[model samples]
Structure formats: structure tokens, C-alpha cells
Target chain A: MKEHATKAAAFIQDEARTNWHDESLWFVRSKRDKAAHGIPEWEQLRELASQIKDHTLSHLDEYLEAFEAKAKENGVTVHWAADAAEHNRIVHSILQEHNARRIVKSKSMLTEECGLNEYLEEQDMEVIDTDLGERIIQLKEEPPSHIVMPAIHLKKEEVGELFHQKLQTKKGATDPQYLTEAARQHLRQSFLQADAAITGVNFAIAETGGVVVCTNEGNADMGTHLAPLQIHCMGIEKILPKAEHLGVFTRLLARSATGQPSTIFTSHHHKAKEGGAMHIVIVDNGRTTQLGRPDFRNSLKCIRCGACMNTCPIYRRSGGHSYDSTVPGPIGSILTPGIDLKKYSGLPFASTLCGSCSDVCPVKIDIHEQLYKWRQIIAEEGHLPTAKKQSMVMAGKVLSRPGWYKMAGKSARWVTRWLPRPLIYNPLNTWGKARELPEAPKESFQEWYRKNRSAS
Target chain B: MSKAHILKAIQAAKPVPCPLPVVPVFEAETPPTREIFGSVAAQSGSRVVRAEDFVGLATAVRTIYPKDISIATPLRAIQSDIDLQQASPADLNGVDVAVIPAQLGVAENGAVWVTEADCVHRVLPFIAQHLVLVLPEDRIVRNMHEAYAQIKIDDTGFGVFIAGPSKTADIEQSLVIGAQGARSLTIILI
Candidate 1:
């Protein structure tokens, strides 16, 4: 896989698109700020949410067992998968048992990580993504650019064209309302004919043995209710100890995600529909490994609100696809490296270490701090690029020796004063490519300080 | 076996236990009222109608929706074109409007709590093109904390907090109401 820098460079080639993407995300960030400011006890809410998640992660095994036992009492089947391959196999077997061919699914990042769509399609089963953004990207044959707004990267004109070709919508109609209507009519048919429905769990309450799915478009509810068979896929960390925790999380989730007071539909499922089957699959793909890393375990507290992505300067400018992970943002940068350090080592370096992501995070995961920590680990593991390693080595040497540092500083000042622009600003100087160095000072700050102090 | 493996791994990797923080109710200086609920509902793109009784609610519903539209409901006062008791989930696809009773209303976010018992068919609220929720004005709560305290989530197989009409901004962040579910929501408070 291409590293983040190379992919980000290609993404930023279109200056207009880059600026538009950055501003669009900034708008969402601003909306989040407004909503958060309106709440009188926002900080207290964040603290409570963070503490709740920390407690749950520490006692995850007990909660999972309790959740399973309660779900069984509720007449819901529970399944567990140790890894991605096992998750895919377990879901397939469930489908096979029911002989379900046509499947409708709501947004589940876990399934994306497990490549469930490709796995089921290989078996000649028809799987349809029901979320509007997800369906758009599925038809366009691309991964989601944003988790909450999956098609945020694409323009309406592009979406209109895609729908025109696939759904037979009116040609050249770029109106979102018109295009959305066409998709609604098209997906309604899929929902009615679907033999089974799949949804992602937003929060699973062990107290009541229910799973909650929140959505603004109601796709999750539409699919799960219409189909005879229902399945919910969740990472084990999604478990909450009690149902009242929903009050804290539900208040924070939509406001943090899109600045809405609440999602249009926050549905809780305790049991299967009358005469229908309900199954919950608890999958631990790499979460246990992450839990082992004390530095990154807090990342599991993420509610998948995408607040970090919206507020991140690097994420806004570089775009989500540049990270090349199931989740692509500040949180993804910290979490993905744990999954495959060698392949995702460059992701941590994509950040500017701006604390906006951490501040915006409802659960208050120290996202930027975790990114910094991952960089240190990457360097120690020898996963850093040769150029970065060499530069850091040279910097370390020059800084440790005062004599060498002074000599280097003098020569650098001399060179900048005398050398031509072409010589100093060459292709080899990556930092100088987009910036111009300030004029060399008459003397170094140390020399100026020493002389002035002595004179005083 | 997979469950045991996952549990063992979690046991080994999980951190030291931390005490769960007690979630507290955030009380407003002045408690939210039905007026606040109506305003908040309007902000989220839902139409709010205040009615004195069931007869006024029926009149408001008739005035708002077209006469030829197919309506589905379990309400005794409101005449529904489609009988939810007899209609299957798929049979309710053509419903133009669905009027259902909400157990309670949240004043802070303009959300209404509805369970399967209220809709009869689980898909009625979403499958219909428009949704009309009949909430009693006296049943409004101040916030989510108060809302959860009042309702038993496990009382029914399925329940939802319907805040507004189903909407999406996926197409270039353009706000478009009515994406695969109801296009508009009208809250009739009786």
C-alpha cells in the first residue's frame, strides 16, 4: 500500500478540491462547536463519558459475558469471532442456515474491516448497502471518504451522474433532493425484497440486553424492521454496562458527529421481530491487541462519531482515503498502526499534532498524544522512512554537541546570506518546496543574548 | 471456542479496573416547557401542531395531509386507510402517512419515544412517506436523562426515539430531507 504522504500528495494536487474539502469539514467542526457550547455541562458530560468508557474497557470481559447471558434470555442468538476471517465465516454460516440470498445492510465499519461484502459476493449472494452515503459509494465502487458522511468527498454533480447511469435518474440533474428521491425509490424495492438485514451496533446495553442503532436517515430501522432475519455486528468494545448510559452517549453522539441534537432515529432492539430471527455477532478482530497496548487502548472508547476527523487539520486537508484504513483520521492513525505497524507507520506522521481532535472527541481520547506516541514506537521498530530516520539522526548529533551545533548554525547563516535562491531552494529541500526561508539574522539568538547580558 | 479465546485475551490485556463515574442529571435553571419542545422540533425540520383533544388532532391531520393519501394508524379516533393489524411489513410500503402515538416527548430535542406496541408494525413509522406522531403535551420530559428514567426500554421488542424526519446530507453536504424513510414529520400534541 502507498504511504500516507504519497497518497496525500496526489490528493492535494487539485488545489481547489483540497481547499473545498478543508472548508467543508471546517463548517462541520464549527457546527459541532456551536452545539457543544449550547450545553451548559458539556465538559462534565465529556468527563463522564470518558470515565464510563475507561471503566468498561477495563472490565470488558465481565460486561461481554453479562451481555451474552442477558441477550440469550431475551431470545437473541449471540456469536463471537476472534478475527476478521472468523467474523466473515460466522456471518456466512448464519446466512446459509436461513438460506438468505438477498441481504440489506446498514453502515458497519467492522464489516468493512472484515471485507464482508466481498466475502459474501464471492458466494453469489446479493448484499445491498442501505445507507444513502454508503449506497452511493458502493455504486461508485469506492470506499467511504468519511464515516458519518460517506460521500462527503464527492460533488452532487458526480452523484447525479452516477445515479443517472445506475438508477436511471434524470440526466444532468444535480439537485440533491431530486437525486435523493430517486435513490429512495430504488432502495425501497431492495428493502422490501431483502431476506435479511444487517446493522452496526452503536451501543449495546448489558443491563437490558439490547443493541441501539442511531441514524439520521432511518436506513438501519427500515432494513431491520422490513426483513425477516436481522443481524447486528459490533466490536466487543461497544458494550455499555447499563441502559441509562445511553442518556449520556446519545446526547453526545449526534451533537459531536453532525451538530444535531439527536439522530432522527435511535432505535433499541431487545428481541427479534415477531416470527423473525435476531443475531448479535461480537467480533474481536484486533481490539484485544490494542487493549494490550496501554498507550492506544483509549482509542477503543471511540463511538465512531467522526468528530476527530472533522476537526483534524491534517485529515481535513489530506482527506480520508489518503490514510487507506477502514477508519481514516486522527483516531485511525493511532489505531491502524497497532494492527499493522509496518504498513501504516506513516499514518502517525500525517498529523500536525494539533489538539483539536482530542478536544472535539466526546469520549476525550488523547488522539494527538497517541499519534505522537505511535511515531516514537514506529521509529524504535525501524518502520520510519530512510529520509526521516537520517534527518533525525543528523539532528540528534548536531544538537548533542554544542560545538558542532554552533559551527553548523554559522555555516547555515552564511550559506543563506550568500547562496542564490535556486541553490538553496532545490528539489532536495522538501521543506522549502512550499515555503520561503526568512532572511538570515545578523547573529544567532545565543550570541545576541550573551552580548546583551554582558553589556547590561 | 471463539468466545473463550476472546474472553481469555481480554482478561490478559484489559487494564486495571477503574470506577465508573456516576452520570448526573444536568438541570436547567428553568425547566424546558412544551414551547421549548415545539421550537426545538421546528429547528430539526419537524412541524409542530398543538391540539386540545383527539378530535382537534384528527382535524389537524386532515388539514395537513391530502385527502387521497393512504394513512396507517393504530389510533382509535383517527381513521386509517390501512389497518396495521392486518397489514404485513411489506404491505405497508405504499402508505403515504403513518400516525402513531408516542409514549412521551423530550422537550430538549423534540424527540418522541415510540415502541412496537404503538406502531403495531415495526416498519410503519419509517416506511411511510410522512410521519405524524401524536404526543400528549403533559408527557414531555426535560431531557434524555429524564426521558430514559420514565420509559422502560425492554418493555417492547423494539423502540425508537424519533427526533425528526429522516434526512441526509451525504450528497456534497447539502441538506436533503427524506432519504430512504419519511420525508417529513408532524408532531401533533394533544
Candidate 2:
């Protein structure tokens, strides 16, 4: 994943809009914080939710079996996928079952992780992302930088140009609302024409064997309501056992995500209406592995509420695209390493370890603590860069012994004054770039503390 | 994640049916506790006040509803408000609110599950002007585990656990709620 990180860094540097992307998401994160902490019962709610997920994880085999049976009885086909590859294949098979050439899809971050659209394209299937932000990025032929706001990197002019070229708009027309409406009109036809609709499950009620799809544009409904075949993709973690949880999550989800009191559309596809066929592909894709690991399992409670990303200082500065995964920001930093240590080794280290993600987390996942844990795990696995490991070892050796600590503190002061500025600057550390390296004081705080202690 | 195929293969080799689920009946017939008002009064985004019986509750529902529109009881009884008997879903599109009975709660996520059983009718809430849900307060929980703990109950009817109102913010980063389901919700805490 070092290679991918390099590529992602290069991509981000070239975009020159990482800060804007970061800040935009951070704004959402702040709103989430306001909403979540605003509730007096917020912390209690989080604990209960966490315990429920733990309980679910322990008896997953039973719940999944029950869910499958109930869903089948409700006329929804349940497909199980062990991994991303299987998930993509199963989705394709479902589309093929109906010989659907064109499909309109809603926002399902799981599909992004599985690379579903690209895979379906390879199979000669036309899968158009109908979400407005998704459509913008799809037009640009880029991955969504932010999960909720896919085209956060694009400016109005850029979007106008893309629309002009693809949709043949009048040259230089940059009206966002007009372009959005036009896209809506254009996509509505696709929703109507498409034979199948593929959507992401927000929360699936095990009791009813139904999946809930939340959308602002009502695209999920426009497509699913019209399309004869519906394909729903969801992670195993989306299961919430009962329905009342929807009230808490839906209230908190929108408010935390964007400070909205509620989301525009929250449609539940219970038993498929009449002749419409519904197929749910529950993809694990490292979730149960994540679930079994007690430390990282709380991440499963994430409703993919990108609030943490929105509020993360590191994410806001570097941007979601910098994380280079389906899920990004503080949440991604932890989830990525669990998926592949080699590929996503840089993620955990990328964070500033600020507690904003956890603070803003509606379900209260200890995001920063997990990031810290991932760092130790990575270092233990020998994935740390040589320079970081060496620095840590040297610091450990000096700090553990008083004699070396005194000598090291004096040497560090001398080095700061004498070493060439260029030599002092570490290209290996991202912290050195842009941010000012604080000058070493004439005396260390520890030295002052010792003197004060003696005088007292 | 254990590959689903592994489970599938296990099923094929052993032909062992998964354990039959035991639906824990939470219906203890305990005396109804009506002393405390729930957080609904605060979060309902509408007026929530207690009522003694059907006469006062129905009277309150009528007062809360606009004079121009009609109201009805029973989730399945929504068809009388309009000639929706033959109205297709497309015809019933652009509904503002839906009031359906919640099956239970998963305090974990602050969600309230609802189902077909609690609605005025199948298409009632999804094809209406607004929704007003009257829930029994004892159903609330601390988190999802507590909710899950109680989910072993029988589900002989349709239900959903609505946390707040239907919502989303998927537009050009603009956060707009009340998309397809209901533009507003009025929870009458009876």
C-alpha cells in the first residue's frame, strides 16, 4: 500500500484542493459534534449501541441465518459474499439475472470499497451513479473524495465544463442549480429507463428483513420505485435487529452529517412491492474480521456518518482523497489497516490523532484511540518506515536512562542551533512541511521542573 | 470475514439447518406505567402531550392536524383520506409525512423500528401529507443491545423503528432533509 499511498499523495498534491475538501468535510463533522453532544442521552445511547453490536457479533451466525430466512420469506433474495471480489461478482450475477444493461445506483460506500461500478463496467454493464455528487465525479472519471460529497474537489466552473462537454450545455454556463437540475432531469430518465436499481442499505431491520435507503434527492426511490429489479448492497454491520433504532440513528445521522434536522428521503424496502424483485447482497469484506478484533470492532457501529472526517483536523488539512480508500478520515485510518497492512500502512500514521472523530462520532467510536492502536500494531508488524522506527528507538534509549536523557537534551539543543536548517528539515516526516518546526528553548522544561522542585 | 461460500459449502455438506430462532415475547402484560413523559416531547419536532383516552387523543390529533386536511385512525386506514384504493405508488408519490406504529426500539442507535402492522395502511404513511405517531413510551431503550435483547419478541405484523424523521443530505454537499417520505413529523405522545 506504500505504492498506493505515494500515488494518492501525488493525486492530492496535483489537485490543489485538498484543503477545501478537508474543510468542507470538517464542517459536516462539526455539525455532527453539535448534534450528538447536544443530546443528554448521547453517551448512553452510544454505549447501548456498542453493546448491541457486540452482542450481534457474538451471535452473528444465528442472526444472519434468521435474517436470510425472513428476507427470503419477504420475497427478497439474500446473497452472502465473503469478500470484496465475491461481492462484486454476486452483484454482477444479480444484474445479469435480469439481463440489465443499465443500472442507476445510490450511495453505498460498500460498493465503493468493492469497486462495484468499475467491476460492473468491466462486465459491459452501464452502472450510472444517480446521486448528484456521484454523477459529478463519474463525469470527471474520478473517485469521490468525500463519501457524502463525491465531487468536493470540483469547482463550479470545472463542473460546468464537465457538464458542457458531456451533457452539451451552452459553453461557459456555470450555474450550479441549473446544472444540478439538468443533471436531475437527465438522470430521472435513466431511473425510469433502467431495468434495475442498486442502492446501499443505511440500516437493515432484522425483524422485518427490510433495508432502509436514505437519500436527499429521492434518487433511491425514483430509481427503486420505477425499476423492476432492485439490488441492495450492504455491509453485515448495518443490521440493527429491530426498527426503533432507526429513529435514533436517522435523527442523529442527518443532524450530525449536515446539521439538518432530518434527511429528505428514508425509504424502507420491506417486502418488494408486488412484482419488483429485491436482492440484498450482505458483504463482509473484512467486517467480521474487524468485529472479532475487540479494539477495532466499534468501527462497525459507524453508520458511515463521515462526521469524523468532517471534523478531523488532519483530514480537513489533507483531504479525504489523501486517505485513498472507500472510507476515509479518522475512520478510514483504522479500517484501512485492518483490510491490508501492506497497502494501507501509511493511513494510521497520517492522522494527528486528534479526538475530533470520536467527539463527533454519533455512535461514539473511540476513533483516535483506534488510530493510536493501529500505529502500535503497524510498528509491531515491522511496517513502519526506517526513519520513524529509528527515531522511536533512540528516544526510548535516551528517555529510559537519566544519564542519556540529560546528554540527549543538551545535544538536541546544540544540534538545533548548529545543524544546518536544511539538514534539520526531515523530508521523511510530513510534519516538517508547511508547519513551522518550533525552535528549541535555551533550557528544557524538565530542567526547570527539577530546579523548582529543589528550591521548594 | 468468513466467506459466505464457506457457510454455503458447510450447508451443502452437512445439510444441517440453522437453529430455529426463538422469538422472545416481551409482552409481560405488566401494568402500564404512564408517570414519566418521554424525550419525545423534546425531540418530536412537534407538540407532544399526554391524553387520557381515544376521545381526547382523537380530539388532540384533529387539533394538531390542519383544518384543510382530513385525518384517520389505524395505519391501514389511510386510504379513506384520498381515493388511494386504486392509486398507484407513482400516483401516491411526493408524500410529506407517514405515521406508522414502531415494532420496537434499539436504544443503541436511537432508532425506532416501524412496520406494516402499525401503519394506517400499506401505502398510508408513504403517501400522505404528514405523519403523526403515537407511541407507548415504555418502548424506548439505552442502546441497540437492549433493543436487540428485546427483538426476540414475535413479529407477526409489519413495523419500523423511526428515530426521528426521514432524511438525507446527498446533494452538492448541501444538507436538506425531508426528501421523499415526509416533509414534517408530529409525534403525539399519548
Candidate 3:
């Protein structure tokens, strides 16, 4: 896969679209601020939520066992998948047991991570994504750019064109309401016809053996309630110790995600419905390995709220597809390195280290700090790009020696000021590609400081 | 095999023990007043009506949908086209309107708690074209914290906190109501 910068360069080619994407995400960030400001205990909620997740993760094994036992007692068949392939296989086996051919799934990023749809397609079972945002990307054969707003990268005109081609809507129609209705009518039929439904878990309460799935469109409910067989996929890190923790998370989630006080529906399922079978697939898929890293373990605290993505300056500008991971943006940068360092080594550098993401995170995952930490680990593991490695090594050597550093600094300042633009900002200068080089002054800061303040 | 592998990994990776913290108690003001709840629910894309009695709720429902062909309700006093007891969940696919009773209401987000016992079919509240949730005036709570305290998860296999009609902003950040579920929500406060 191409590096994040390469994809981001291509994505930002259209200045108008880039600005629209940036502003669109900023609008959500401002809404989040407003929502957060509305609650008197918002900071308290963040702290408490962080604490709860921290405690649960410390005792993750106990909670997972408790959650599994309770869920089994509630008549749910709980399956644990150590990886994505096992998860896919477990879901397929369930469908095969039920003789279910048509599958309707709501927004489950875990399933997307597992490549469940592709796996099912290979197995000759028809799969339909029911979430409006998910359905748009599913039709386009693209991965979701934004977690909450999956189709945020596409313009209405593009969506209209895609719908016109796929659903045969009016060729020139760009109205969201009209296009949404077309999806509604089309997916409703699939919901009715689907023999099985699959959804993602938002919170799995270990104490009560229940899973909560929140959605604004109620697609998860519509699909699961209609289908006789239901499968819910959850990462192991999703477990919470108690149901009361939901009050804290539910309050913060939608507010952080899209500024809604709450999602339209927070459906709690403790057991399989009457005469129907339910399956819960607990997926590890690098979570346990992530948990072992003390510095990076906090990344598991993410509730997948996508607040970090919205608040990230780089993410808003570069777009989600730039990261080229199942989850993207700041959280993905810190996470993907743990999963596959070599393949995703460039992701850690795709940030400005603004710390906006950490400030906005509901669970208070120190996202920016983790991103910085990942960069160091990537370099140590010999996974960094050659240019970055060479530059860092050269800079390190120069900075460690005071005499050489001063000489190099003075020489660089002289070179920057006297050298021609072509000579100074050539192929080796990656920083000057999208930005102008700063004007160098005649005297260095150290020189001026000594002259002014050394005797004072 | 994956289950054992995962559990073993989790056990081995377990961190230093940290006891679960007690959830901080939030002592806010009382739940929203009838007027406040009405406005909040309205902002969430739902119509809220102060219905003094069952008859008043029926009147509001009729006013909301004057010419609808089919209406399903579990309420005994309210007359409707389909009785939830007799209708299959799949059969409620295109129901024009459904008047179901909500167990409780959360004022913070204008969400009403509805359990499976209240909804005859698990799909009744969602499959209906327009959903009318009849919430009693006394059942409203100040926030989700209080709402969670009062409800019992084990009492029902399925339950939901429905704040408004189904909605989405997926198509270029436009708020489009009724994406794949109820197009409108009417909370008739009794």
C-alpha cells in the first residue's frame, strides 16, 4: 500500500473538496465542544470513564470470563476468536448451521476489520450493509473513510451518481433526504428478506451479561429483530465491569461523535429473542498484544467514538483513506503499529502532534503521546522510512556535540539565507514541498542571547 | 481453540490489579418538566404532546396521522388497524403508524425506555413507518444516570432507549430522518 502522505497528497489535490472536508469535520468538533460544555460533570465523566476502562482492562481476563459465563447463562452462544480469520469462520459456521443465505449487517467496524463481508461473499452468501453510511461505501466497494460518518469523504453529487448507477435513482439528484429514502426503501426489503443479521457491540456489561448497540437509524434493531438468527461481533476490549458505566459512556459517546445528546436508539440485548439463536463473537485480533504494552495498552480504552479523528488536524485535512487501515486517524496510527509495524510504520509520522485528539477523547486515551511513542518504537525496530532514519541520525549526531551543533547551525543559517531557491529547496527537502522555507536571520539565537544576556 | 488461545493471552497479559472505581453520583435537578421534555424531544426529531389521558393521546395520534391507512397499537383504549398481539414482526414491515407504550423516559436526551414486553414484537417500534411512544408523565428521569439506576436489565431480553425517529447525516452531513426505521416519533405524554 502507498504511504499515508502519498494518498493524502492525492486526496488534497482538489482544494475545494479538501476545504469542505476540513470544515465539515470542524463543524462536528465545535458541536462536540458545545455538547461537552453543556454537561457540568463532563470532565468528571471523562475521568470516571477512563478509570472504569482502566480498571476493566487491568482485570480483562476475569471480566471476559464473567461476561462469557453470564451470556451463556442468558442462552447466548458466545464464541471467542483469537484473530480475524477465526471470527469470520465462526460467523460463517453460525450462518451455515441456520442455512441462512442472505445476511444483513449493521455498522460493525470489527466485521470490517475481519473482512467478514468478503469472507461471506467467497462462501457464496449474499451480504448487505444496512447502515446508510455503510451501504454507501459498500455499494462503492470502498472502506469507510470516517467511522461515524462512513461516507463523509464523498460529495452529495458523487453519492447521487453512485446511487443513480447502483439504485437507479434520478441521475442529477443530489438531495440527501431523497437519496437516503432510496436506500431506506431498498434496504428495508433486504431487512425483511435477510435470514440472519449481524451487528457490532458498543458495550458489553460483564456484570449483567448484556451488550449495547447504539445507532441513530435503528438499522441494527430493524435487522436483528426481523432476522431469526443474529450475530454480534465485539472486540475483547469492549467489556465494561458494570451497567452503570453506560451512563458515563452513553452521555459522552454521541456528544463526542456527532454532538447528539445520545444516539436515537441504545438497544440492550441480554439474551437471544424468543425462538431465535444469538451468537456473540469475542475477537482478540491484536488487542491482547496491545494490552501487553504498558505505554500503548491505553489505546484499548478507545470506544471507537471517532472524536480523535474529528479533532485531528491531519486527519481532517488528509482524510481517513490516507491511513490505509481498518481504523484510521490518530487512534489508528498508534494502533496499527502494534498490529503490523512494517506495513503501517509511516502512520505514526502522519500527525502534527497537536494533542487535540487526546483532549477530545472521551475515554481520555493519550492518543498523541502514544503516536509519538510509536514513532520512536518504529525507528528502533528499523521500520522507519530511510529518509526519516537518515535525517534523525544526522540530527542526533549533530545535536549531541555542542561545538559541531553551533557550527552546523551557523552554517545552515548562512546557507538558507544566501543559497538560491532551487539549491536550497530541491528534491532532498521534503518539508518544502507543500510549504515555504522560513527566512533565516543573519545571527543565530544563541549568538544574540550571549551578546544580550550572558553578562546581565 | 481460538477461545482458549485468547483467554490464555489475556491471562498472561493481565496488568497490575486496579479495583473498579465507584461511579460518582450526579445530583442534578429534577427531570425535565412537561414543557421542557416536549421541547427537547422536538429537537431530537420527535413530536411531543401533553396528553392528559388515553383519550387525549388517541386524539393526538389521530391528529398526527389523519389519513393513514394502517395503525398498530398495544394500548387497549386506542383503536388501531393492526393488533400487535396478532401481527407477526415481519408483517409489521410497512406499518403506517404504531402507538406503543414506553416504560420510562429520560429527559436529558428525550429518550424513552421501551422493553420487549411493551413492544409485542421486537420490531414494532422500528418497523412502523411512524412510531408513537406513549410515556406516562411520572416516569420521566433527570438523566441517563438516574434512568440506569431505576431499570433492571435482567427483566427483559430486549430493550431500547429510543430518543427520536431514525435518522442519519451520512449523505454529505445532511440530517435526513427515517433512514431505515420509523420516519417520525410521537411521544404522547400521559
Candidate 4:
């Protein structure tokens, strides 16, 4: 995978688009603040959510069995997949059993992580993403940029252009309403004809053997309710002990995501509708491994609200696609490292260590702290870039010895003053390329302190 | 075999037990009002209409949508172009408006509790271009906590808390009223 910084540089090449993306996410962050402030027990609710997740994750084995048994009693077929490949095979086999050639699906990052679409296409099944944003990116043949808003990085004109090419919409039409209406009319046909629908579970109630899927577009419900067969794909971490827990999460989810009171639709599916078959695929896919890591397992507490992404300075500017992970931003940085430490080592360094992401997070994942921890692990495991490792090692040696450090500091100031512009701002100096180095001080802090304090 | 392997991994890696925190109860200071419901619903791109009874709902829905539009309903008095009971979920794709009953309404978010029993097809409320819900005025609750306390999940196989019209701000964070579901939502409060 390409380093995040390399991809971010490409994303930031268009200066205007970067600013638009940043400001747009910041606007959502502000709306989240307003929605959160309106509720007096917002912080308490967040803490409760965190605690509930902690409790459930601690007893995951028991709850998983409980949830599966209950779902089976409700006449739902529950399947377990050890990995992404197995998950894809199971879903494809189910579709094959029903002779389903065409399928409509809502936004499920789990499907993206599993590469389900590609797997299904190879099996000669057509998968149409029904969420408008998801559809926009899918038509463009790209992964979703943001978890909540899939096509958030794209401009209206780009979407209009994409629609022109794919859907044959009127040329030069960029209005979201007009574009959305076109998508609706187009996807409506897919929904009506598709043999099955698949959705992502927001929360799986262990008590009732049911699942809740929240969506602003109501795309999940529309597709699932229309199709003859419905399937919900959920990671093992999505379970909650009781149905009453919906009150806490439902209030926090949309408000933290897009800053609404709630998503337009929070559909609870207890069983399959009349004659339809409802299936639940609970996939492990490295989650069990993640739970084993004491420091990073809290990462599983994420509700996929995208609050961390909205609040992340680097993510807002660099764009979500830069991380090169299914779920991007701070959460992805923590998550991706555990799954593939060598490939995603650069992700942890992509942040400013601002801790804003943690504060804004509904489940309160210590994102910046985990990023710091990952950096140390990456360095220790020799996963860090060679240049970074070498420089850090050299700096560590110099900083360890006081006399050498002072001499080095003095030489650094001397070199900055005497060296030519081209010599000082070379390719090796990564910080100097985009920004100028700070002017060398007349005296080091030690020198100034010694002179002032000794005489007094 | 996969289940056992996965569960074994989880059991081995599991952290020490942390008890679930006591959920705090949030009491709304202000009583539920029709105005609060209307404004909150409006914030989510849904309109709230006050009607005296079922007969008035027909007039209200007609005023908002043209007569040529295909209106579907499970309600008795509302004049509808399509009978939802007779139409399959997929067949209701072209429906312009669907009038359904809501079990209760929450004032804080303008969410209305809708169950499968209230809908002829589970997709009726979502598939329509526009939706109208007839909720009794007295059924409005203060917040979601109250609504959940009153909800019986076992009785209905399916249910949803619909807050507003289907929406998305995905494209450059521009607010789009309609995405894949109903373009608009109208709640007829009687």
C-alpha cells in the first residue's frame, strides 16, 4: 500500500478542494457540538456507551453464543466466518442457493473490508450499492472515502460528470437534488429487481436476537424490505447485551455523525419479514486478534459514527482515501496497524497527536495515545521507514548525552547562520521543504540560564 | 470449528471484567408540545401538520401533493391511489405518498415509532417519494429514553424510529433532501 503522506500529497494538489473538504467536515463537527450540547446527559451517555462496550467485549464469547442462539430461535440463519475470504464465500454461497443473480446492498464497510463485491462479481452476481453516496463512489469504481459519507471527497460537478457517463443523466447538471433524484430513479429499478439485499448492523441486541441498522437515506430498509431475501453482515464487536441500549446509542450515533437528532431511519429487524429469509453473518476477520492486544482492543468500541474523522485535522485536510484502509482516520490508524503492521506502519505517523479525535469520539477511543504507542511498536519491530529509523536513532544518541547535545545544538545554530539557502533547504530536510526552519537563537536556553542565574 | 477457534481466541485475549455502568436517566424539562415536534421534524426536513381527525388528513395530504401523484395508504378515511395491502413491497416502487400510522412520536428528535403491523409492506413508508404518518397528539413522548421504555420489541417482528425525510450531505457536504428513500416526510398529528 502507498504511504498515507504520498496519497495525501496527491489529494492536496488541488488546493481549493482540500479547503472545501476541511471546512465541510469542520461544519459537521460544529453541528455535532450543538447537538451534543443540547442533551444534558451527553457525556454520561458516552461514558455509559463506553462502559457497556467494555463490559460486552470482556464477555464477548458468552454474548456471541447468546446472540447466535437467540437469533436461531427467531428463525434466522446465523453463520460464522473466521476470515474475510470465508465470509465472502458464505455470502456468495447463500446467494447461489437462492439463484440470486442481482443483489442490492446498503452501506456496509464490513463488505468493503471483505472485498465482497469483487468476490460476488467473480461468481457472476451483480452487486448494486443503494446508498446514494455509496452508489456515486461505486459507479466511479472507488472505495468509500469516508465511513459515514462515502462520496464526501467528491464535488458536485464531479458527481454530475460521473452520472453523465454512467447513468446518462443530462450533461452539466450538478444540483444534488436533481442528481439524487436521478440516482433514486436508477437504483429504484435495481431495488425492485434484485433478488436479495444486504445491510450492515449498527447494533445487534443480544437479548432479543435482533439487529438495528441506522441510515439517513433509509437505503438499508428500502432494499431489505423490498427484496425476497435479506442479510445483515456484522463484525463480532457490534453486539450489545440488551435492546434497551438502543436508546443510548441511537441518540448518540447520528448526532455525533452528521449532527442530526437521529438518522432518518433506525430500523430494528427482529425476524425476517413475512416469507423472506433473514440471515446474519458474524465475521471474526482479525477482531479476535485485536481483542487480544490489551492496549489497542479498545479500538473495537468504535460505533462507526465517523466523529473521529470529522474532528481529525490531518484527516480533514488529507482526505479519508489517503489512509488506504476501509475505515480511515484515527480509528483506522489504530485498527489497520494491528491487522497489517508492516503495510500500515505509516498510518500512525499521519496524525498531529492533537487528541481532538479522542475527545470527540462517542465511544472515547484513546486514538492519539494509541498512535503514539503504535509508532514505538513500529520502530521496535523495524517497520518504520529506514530514513525515519536512522534519524530517530541518531537523534536519540545525541540527546542522551548532555555535552554532545549542547555541542550539536551550538553547531546546528552555526550551520544555519553560515550555510547558503540551497544547502540548508536540501531534499534530506523534509520539514524545510514545505516550511522554513526557525531562525537560530543567539544563545541556547542552557547558556542563557547559566549566565542569568549564576550572576544573580 | 471456526466458531470454537474464534471464541477461544476471544476468551484467551479478553480483558478483566468491567461491569456495565449504570445508565443515567435524562428527564426533559419541558413537556412535549406539538410545536417542539413540528420544529424538530422541520430540522430533519420533515413537516408536521395538525389535523383534527382522519378526514382532515386526506385534505392535508392532497394540499401538499398533487392529485396525479400516486398516494398509497393503510388508513381508512384517506383517499389513496394505491391499496398498500394489495401491493407488494417491490410493486410500491412508484408510489408518490404513503400514509401510515405511527405508534408514538418523540418530541426531542421528531421521531415516530412505526411497526410492521402499521405498514402493509415494511417498505411502504420508505419506498414512497413522500411519506405521511398519522400520529395521535397525546402519544408524543419527551425523549428517546421514554419512547424505548414504552416500546415492546417482541410483539412486532420489525420496527423503526423514523425522524425525518431521507437525506444525505455526502456530496461536498451539501444538504440533499432526498437520497434513496422518501424525498419528504409529513406527519399528520391528530
Best-first order by TM-score: 1, 3, 4, 2
Model 3 residue runs over 4 Å out of place are A449-456, B53-55
What tens digits encode model 2's per-residue C-alpha lDDT throughout A101-146?
Answer: 8998988798988999999999998998888788888888888877
lDDT of 3 by residue, B61-162 (tens): 888788876888888878878767677788897689998999888878889999999988999999999999989998988888888998986679999999
Among the numbered candidates, top TM-score falls to 1
Ranking by DockQ: 1, 3, 4, 2
lDDT tens readout by residue for model 1, B1-190 = 9999999999999999999988787878777688999999999999998876435877888888966378888999889898777889999999999999999999888899999999999999999999999998889988898888889999999999999999999888889999988999999988
1 versus 4: better TM-score goes to? 1
List per-prediction Cα lDDT, in the order shown: 0.93, 0.66, 0.91, 0.90
Off by over 4 Å in 1: B53-55
lDDT of 4 by residue, A158-211 (tens): 999999999999999998878888988898889889899999999999988999
Best by lDDT: 1
Error of 1 at A94 (Å): 0.6
Worst 10 residues of 4 chain B by lDDT: B51-60
The list of candidate 4 runs beyond 4 A from truth reads B53-55, B66-69
Over the stretch B3-61, how does candidate 2's per-residue lDDT look in tens digits? 45535433332212323223322232322232222343234333344544435555555
The positional error of residue B56 in candidate 1, measured at the CA in angstroms, is: 1.9
lDDT of prediction 4: 0.90
